[model samples]
Target chain A: MVKVTCPICGGKLDIPEDSLPGELFEHEDCGAHLELVINEGRFELKLAEEIAEDWGQ
Target chain B: MRIGLAYDLIRWEEKALAYTIKDLGHTLELIHVPESVFYLTEPTIRGLDVTFERCVSFYRALASSLTLEAQGVFVVNTFDVIRNCGDKMLTTAVLAKKGVPVPRTMIAFDKVRALEAAKTIGYPVVVKPIYGSWGRMIAKADDESSLLDILDFRENMPSPHFQIHYIQEFIRKPGRDIRAYYLWGEVPVAIYRVSRNWKTNTALGARAEPANLDESTKELVIKAGEAMGSGVLGVDLMEDEDGRIVVSEVNAVVEFKNTVRVTGYDLPRKIVSSTVEALKA
Candidate 1:
């Protein structure tokens, strides 16, 4: 039940625990995707698209 | 009254500190940072005793001499805040976590992963050095190849680099960004930074203009500063397409050239007075 938000529209997002550390979580409200990573002992988010096909699958 | 000013040879901060000390009738101890330690390693306190051994070699010498327990000395901004603000990746992550609006950003450890991440972030994304300032090494990429070319050059360099996760919004005011200067949670002045280049930094030949401190902008700046737990700050902000404001970054020990010139406010006096009051309490 991790709380996330849209990088573009600032809407609330729900991130499933199974999502990989470097996966992208898209916001339903504004279609904004964020890059998720673990930094400084907590889950951090970044806005990134996938380079290869094996991203956020 | 002798006060020690510690910073690298950045003209803005240097001038601000000099003016403040001189006007306040205090002797200034100018600590000239040599080329070797211009980029000090970010500080982290591991279980007390304040170890700086992990910092660069040159800082080891300076760290040992610093009196962390000095009485009657007012640190312009504490070392802790400076360390946090120095890392862009860390700073944005903290602000975003606290529900502050920050542009979308990302960081990857290696080039392979970074390439994958960059593609996911999409085109027209900005790539910035994780530990850089004054708009140095900031690049915009429209595709994977361009990003790779930039990354290849950066990887070959001696310093480390990180990718900026894209923020899907136009610069509300092109070649312009807002900087709000705060003293102890109060904004004394707000300045708009304008430049023809994408990076609107005063250091990069940008022009400075006085900005009206609207209530919402002021609130956002204050919230961003408080999120980072910074006392004296220069907060960078921009508006999105939907007219929503998001914080770009926060600098702990802010440079005050354009701020002073635009607002016609004495930033040094405000900083010194606020610092001294904080120390007294």
Candidate 2:
């Protein structure tokens, strides 16, 4: 597990070793959804895209 | 086999599908749609056996599927399925033509004719954007005043897509609606999106519970799938005031994560395996 801080809230999140890039993890404490991204060889967390009007099932 | 997964946003469904495909020992390529540029002359997606179209946005899903399909990649939920299900009008027409029961719907191009159509369908009708989901931009107009108010807002929208009214009869449902997973020819699992609000979309706080599909529902769902040209589909059904099951809409790029959670069904695995079977065929 890799430890990272929630960018939206200062809470901790544990990313699984098998977690792939573009997979989403929710910060339960802050109720924010974060995306797992690999930037410059390091895995980082960023807020997921807001639901756009065209986004649907 | 080499498989491609085309997606705009990675949700639980996408991730589950990706993991499932990997677990099945298939070579998986993630086609990030936002960054991947498709050239009309040159096919970028070469050597992939099949591509599962998982784009949440209808436009992105259709555009990517068209390009990928033209490149000779067999897209799950082909270009036709994406195009038909992306627009409610097209979905309704396809279902109705196939003898599948759908809510009475009328299309109008302008506000005046829209009101006329609404009056014909009777008041308290549901106005929907032809191309939307998750219950967004859906308004129930109880009377002329309410409908006018709704139409006025749409009249000024920048996109003409909003102006093209797709009005449907608001079925007096039993405080819930059905969302069934139609894969290829089978209805694997279904859930009742129960909500106090009239809009029963899971995205809008509707609680999901496992639903038992009767033979009639299973048949209807399968028929609807056939009408839509097959793939992974989410068929939304609602019981009308007269207790008849009617198809509310069909989603080509259906999300199954919630259905899996609520029912404990291995939908992602099923989807991956089924997609592989489709590839072989």
Candidate 3:
């Protein structure tokens, strides 16, 4: 399992080993939605942005 | 509980679904559609009770839904529903057969017959691709000259589908159209996409205003959804000069950002709740 920290609340997350980058996860303790990412092989989490239908016509 | 999201690109709607799943005490998996390979047999995508189909491309959405369903994964806006709502020709046929009021439409495969069909429908008819959305490639032939010019462009197009002339009578509405987000055939919210232009798609910068449908209109919307199989969808309708509301189109993969904004309703919550309920059944 990949261990990461939620940027929104500093809560630790045990991300799945199979989880890919750009995968979204929610913090159990802080209840914050975050994206599981990697920078230089280091796990990173960023608060997810709100969904928008920018492509809607 | 776990929910899988089959998506091509990340959009606000996807994020909302993920957030809602999490808030509801479930895990959300973002299974990127372009990267996930569909297996003809056995299992490929696993670890989910159900999946929310959110691919922007109609072809991808339909194919992915079929593959997921094959693996016993419940997909919102199921494969059959996607196909029925995504194709204009099939959708119109269903609506007409169901006695759901829709614009008078005719299709022809050749340029000569296309002109003839347009004349029969009278001038100022709409020429649209059999498969498309967002008001793209839709032309209004106001007269014989405009119809010929539009057909000239369509005839020379390389895509064979474009060569097929899908003609429909353009209902003269009062500078706006109705767009309602139906969660399993229930219209929780509706909005008016007001545009001075003939095309009132919100993608073209149409202003949104909260609206409500009358009793009859609600029945028509439900019938349209039933014709395509039930799931979360966007149903489009228009009011003619005589105040008759007619079903224009049904979007299987609908965008509800504007509806949420103007109506002040928690659409994501409602959608997630509906999804959870469907999964249980």
Tens-place lDDT digits, model 3, residues B1-281: 88888886555677677778889888888777766788969886677788888887777888999999999888988988888888888989988998889999999988789888988899799998878788888999999889889889988987788877899999999999998777776878889999999999887789999998888787877887777777898889999999888899999878887888889998988988987886667
Q: List the residue pairs that clash in candidate 3.
A: A51-B12, A52-B12
In candidate 1, position B222 carries an lDDT of 82
As a whole number from 0 to 100, the lDDT of residue B35 in candidate 2 is 65
Put down candidate 1 lDDT per residue, B1-281, tens digits, no spaces.
55655533224445565666668876755443222233234442122211111111213223422333132223445555655666677788889899989876767666687777766666767777666567766777777788788877777776433333322323445568888886677887888888878788887798999999788788888888888875788898876556778888787656776678777888878877776565556
**Share of native interface contacts recovered by each model:** 0.00, 0.76, 0.07
Off by over 4 Å in 2: A2-14, A25-34, A45-47
Q: How many clashing pairs per prediction, in order?
A: 11, 0, 2
Q: TM-score, chain B only, every model?
A: 0.78, 0.98, 0.96
Stretches > 4 Å off in candidate 3: A1-57
Per-residue lDDT of B35-100 in model 2, one digit per residue for the tens? 678876785667899899998888889899999988998899899999999899999999999999
Ranking according to lDDT, highest score first: 2, 3, 1
- For candidate 2, the TM-score is 0.92
The models' CA-based lDDT, in order, is 0.62, 0.89, 0.83
